[model samples]
Target: MAASAEKLLNLLLRHGSLSRADLAKAMHLSRPAVSGLVDGLIRQGVLRETGCGASNGGKPPIMLEPVAERFGTIGVDIGHETLLRGVLCDASGKQLAVMELPHGNTFESISEQALKLAASLKAAASIPVAGFGVAVAGQVDHAANEIVYCANFPLKNRGLAERLAAGSGLTVRLDNRARAAAQWEYYFGAADNAEDFIFISAERGIGTAIYLDGKLFSGRAGVAGEIRSLLLPSPDGIGLLPVEQAMSEKFLLELSGNCPDTAGLVTAWRRGEPGAVRTVDYLIGGTVYVTGLLTNLLDPALIVLGGRFRDLGPEFARELATRLKVDPPRQLEFRLSKSGRIGAALGAALGVILENCKSNEP
Candidate 1:
């Protein structure tokens, strides 16, 4: 595959259906060149013609879309604690099947469980599974195909990607779960039209992924999104604490009388419970602080809130706008992600497809 072909494929993956003329204009190439790329991809079984588009006064041009029943990828999101999520996605980033499991006690058991999950997802796929992606919370060595270190996860510096590839006989990828979630938001969720934005995931801790000019920004050493150590005013207005402690799920649960989860905390807040109300207010403050910090530094066009906090619904976004203040001539948008629990898994699979395009793989 040529570079132009990869770009065309990615464009279609993002925008869905487009005609050859639209592709030519977007790619800044001649119609012949775009046609050639389209034809080649169609022959390769990744792209397909999807009927015709409306035209002004001439014959309608043929529209193209990704083949949703052919090439596919499997993804596994290893959560910080007991939860693990897996999904089988087509080339167009649509989830065809999903599976969930509890994390195993040890590294070997977890690895085996992940492999089995991947195998099960592959078996459930109607299309050919081209690759497997594993998304974790902490550092990842993509070049080495290993998990460098995840504070809350059991595995450390394990050749998880290689082990999965060898076990499943497919290409493998490893990445940060926050970044993977960001990818899902950018392509299929609220940030579809955004070129610069911040995706904040409030899970066990605070994690973020930055997109500048439509590209994911991984800072030097691939730790750009790790803000867990950033110190801020504590929720109780008692001195300062790191984000991991100040805005963590554990803190929220504890503050809400150890509610089973965020959903229950919301229920308590709805009932006008003082503890739950305080907890929600504290989280809102923390989110506003973090959003302000990032917005001032980067001046992004949008901010997306994900993870357990998404259950807070539109009221969270509305409250964030009320508390967060920005200067004149610069407007910021906030949106809550609707990707659900399978979002990271879907994004991990989409990562495999995007990487495949970049690598010129079939």
Candidate 2:
């Protein structure tokens, strides 16, 4: 990529749009160089003339912005508590359409389910879909694109993405959900401004994915974030199971009414009912204890909270931060992700994008 073009793309992604002179100043590139790159992007349909913008002096320039509707990508995240959230985006990652699929454990149905997900997405797509991405909750062998172990969807360990690709006639890419979600943070969210960060999530299960020196820290077995299996001791004599059992999708639902779904718990939490706050307190407390241990060991620059449970934002961060102070957590920055649920989907798509970029792009 041309150096000036790359800088202009980054600026456009971060700030949404800019007139030619504004982009030139932001990138510190000459006006002619900026204009050349912007013209190329416009001709490729990667950027478009959105309209005029006011100027402090002289006539207003035609405002330019990313043309995100020109292309699209599909992102899938599936685990014990399954979901198929596919985003249609352009080169700049502006979401055009989204289709969501949520289900429970049903692992024995992986092949058929994956095909269904792809087909449904292809059917609903309004534009040419360029790629497909899948993120699973488990340790991954990215070279083989296979899940090594999954607590939620055990059968997902097979060549599931390949099987789906054969069924749909579209090449597929797969990655660990934690790492994929963390990838979103590194490329597009809070971690975008940091060199290294740790991401923890709570969905049907608790998952962790770390980024170090601007890359996914998939040390050894690509199992860096399997903290659900950390096995902390319980306060009572009951010997600890994984903290996921104590503070996860199952626990949240159990903490609220014994609904068959996590939606009930979120609904109650959003309502700010006393029971919901108490439940959040208990779970966040456990999360803080475990995360404090991680901070001492991993020592990431920032700690990001993602996944479904993070919807409980301030309550989640406050409890985690407050308790950490008592034990003196060695100064970890606890923050909610800027991308939220959308980041998970973007992470999945990025797995595919990264693969192609490394091999096919010049």
In lDDT terms, which candidate is top?
Answer: 1
Q: For model 1, what is the C-alpha lDDT against the true structure?
A: 0.84
lDDT of 2 by residue, 2-121 (tens): 555655665666567789999988777788877787787777666788889987798989888766655466777774356656665555565556666665556546556666766787
CA shift at 10, candidate 2, in angstroms?
7.6
Candidate 1 regions exceeding 4 Å error are 359-362
Compared to the true structure, candidate 1 yields what TM-score? 0.95
Regions of model 2 farther than 4 Å from truth: 1-70, 80-82, 102-104, 235-237, 255-278, 326-331, 359-362
lDDT score for residue 317 of model 1: 88
**By summed lDDT, which 10 consecutive residues of candidate 2 come out lowest?**
353-362
